[model samples]
Target: MTTPQWAWAFEAADGTPVEGTVSPVFTNRFDAEQWLGQGWREMAETGIASAVLLAEGKVAAPAVRLSSDV
Candidate 1:
């Protein structure tokens, strides 16, 4: 079987992918979430309004609002 691909999908307030933002890929969900827990604030500061966990290019969880204003 193929291994699952885990990654973060970041978006702007309007629901479009953030320009210049690259999603960091992980081998598992735990690591992906851990990284987000540590770096979400920085992502919000950089115009990322929301984030979604993706597994195999599909949504694994609901979008999380990063910016309070969004």
Candidate 2:
């Protein structure tokens, strides 16, 4: 079986990912996703308005807003 490559898409307040290179590569999709789940708040604190999970170089999940209420 081929292990999946996972990456992050960092977005701005307007909900668009800032144009640039993708994040560091992750070997395990689960670890990548869990890291995002745990770190998104901190990312938002640092001006990352939103984020999404990328599976094999494509959007895997809907965008997740910084706020929990969303």
Candidate 3:
């Protein structure tokens, strides 16, 4: 079996994928969440309106709004 790959998928307010946003692939969900915790503010400022955790290229969690007004 292959190990699961965890990452965040970022999107704009209109639901399109954010251009130039690259999430670092993680070995576990914890690491992926931790990274988001630290980087979400920056992401929000950089046009990322929301994000969702992805595991093995599938959504692993509900989408999280990065912008407070979103």
Best by TM-score: 3
RMSD of each: 0.9, 2.7, 0.9
Candidate 2 residue-wise lDDT, 1-70, digit = tens: 8977888888888766667635677988778878888877778676777778888989988887876433
Cα miss at 16, model 2 (Å)?
2.4
How many angstroms is residue 42 displaced in model 3 relative to the true structure, after the best TM-score fit? 0.6
Model 2 — TM-score against the truth?
0.73
Give all candidates' CA lDDT scores. 0.92, 0.77, 0.92
Q: Where's the lowest-lDDT run of ten residues in candidate 2?
A: 14-23
lDDT of 1: 0.92
Measured with C-alpha atoms, the lDDT of residue 31 in candidate 2 is 85
How do all models score by TM-score? 0.92, 0.73, 0.92
Query: Candidate 1 lDDT, tens digit per residue, 4-70?
Result: 8899888999999987888888989999999999999999998999999999999999998999877
lDDT of 3 by residue, 1-69 (tens): 888899888999988998888999999999999999998899999989999999999999999999975
Model 2, position 58: C-alpha lDDT score? 92
How many clashes (backbone N, Cα, C below 3 Å) per candidate?
Answer: 0, 0, 0
